[model samples]
Target: MKVGLGLPISDPPSLLTWARRADAGPFTTMGLLDRIVYDNPEPLITLAAIAAATTRIRVQTEVLLAPLREPVLLAKQCATLDRISGGRLTLGIGVGARPEDYLAVGADYATRGRRVDEMMPVLRRIWSGQPHDDQVGPIGPAPTRVNGPELLFGGFVPAALKRVARWGDGYLSAVPVERTDPLFRMVEKEWGAAGRAGRARLVGQVNVALGPDSVVEDAKQTIGSYYASLAGTYDVHMVTTADQIRTTITGFADLGADEVMLYCWAHDPDQVDRLADLLA
Candidate 1:
């Protein structure tokens, strides 16, 4: 299975350093969390920086809020990033759930799902270079590839799954241990309905921790707040040793996940090294 590293975009200095490190490591892809007003960097800008610094690692926005921005503009930005990255960009999009995020961006949270549905066709049109009165003609100087970046839709709701079937090239799911079967079932159904059963990719994200007592304790202290809200839900973060992580990742692959993005909540750079070793 393809492995990706999820960096904390909230810390620009550390994120940049980690991106460079990950580029030199075994990771095939690097992902950034998208949060406009929260404690995260703007994904496109961060991705652009990563594209400039790395030569091979594919860059991804592991769930950008599509409903908050104008589709055309976002599409243009993604296309530009794809060009810079030599077509190594994957645009992971979702209708954000946080009401405060929507309010902060002056978007109605209730209308986000509908807005995302409306924006997707426009975004795809922009990517495909289809002439549209609403879109910027031809998407600028052209992308590195004929199509723009790969588009992945993320969310757990049935409506979200339907949207993935209708509009996305793949599904990005954060599957809890209990919900894994249902999530894969929905993805399979959607993929079949979209006529993309084998074509569509499945990328799953999981929280991980590795090493001895001090290391584990340190990781918990650093990432505990970030996962505090997801303690019991399907979003429950997993804290496991390196061996456990390898076993779990293998399980995900067995369940048809094409790629698994490891979100290491630990701030230590050594954690990435440990993860790379464990995965190896």
Candidate 2:
């Protein structure tokens, strides 16, 4: 299975460090998460910077909340990032959780699912240089990857899976690392019913913080704080330690994951290096 790292985009100042390290490492992709109401960097802008900082590791929005932004603007930004990265971009889209985030962006949370469905065609048309808003012709410069970056859809529900079958080149499963099988099966079934040929990419994700016991606890606390809204609702293991992380990833790979990205939860930039050590 391929390995990827989720950049702690909140740590903007050290992004270059992480990017260079990622480029120098045994990593397949450097990814970002999307959230409007968080202390995080804008995914596309950060990727543009990383595109300039690194050359080898692919950069991606592990799951950007596409419905929150203006579709045309989103298309341009993604296209530019793809150009800057010389086509090394993977795009994952989803209607995010967190109603407060949609509220912050003035987006209608209730209709985001349908809105995203609408935005897909708009994004594709704009990415292909086709213009809208009464413009004369095509939009900005085309992405290096013909039309745009490869797309993956995130969200585990049946409705979400239907969209995944419709638009995604892959399925970015958001379920916990352990409970991914049922969702992956759903993806396969949907893809087949949609008459899609070839294997759909199965990407698994996990929140992980690795270090000594004390550092581990601190990392777990950080993750807990990040997902506090889900607290007391469901059980989740705040992964810590190299062995645990390895087992988790290997388990996902054994279950047929094409790629697995560990959400590095520790705040320190050194955590990147530590993760490299473990994987090495």
Report the C-alpha displacement of residue 199, candidate 1, in angstroms.
2.9
lDDT of 1: 0.77
Give lDDT tens digits, candidate 1, residues 51-116. 899889999988888888987788788888998888999999887656777888788899888998
Q: Could you give candidate 2's per-residue lDDT for residues 114-171 as a string of tens digits?
A: 9998998888888777666585577786998666789999886788888877877888
Question: How accurate locally is residue 250 in candidate 2, as Cα lDDT from 0 to 100?
Answer: 90
Q: Where does candidate 2 stray beyond 4 Å?
A: 131-136, 233-235
TM-score, structure 2 vs. true: 0.93
**Model 1 ranges with Cα > 4 A deviation:** 134-136, 212-215, 227-234
Best by TM-score: 2
Clashing residue pairs in candidate 1, if any? none
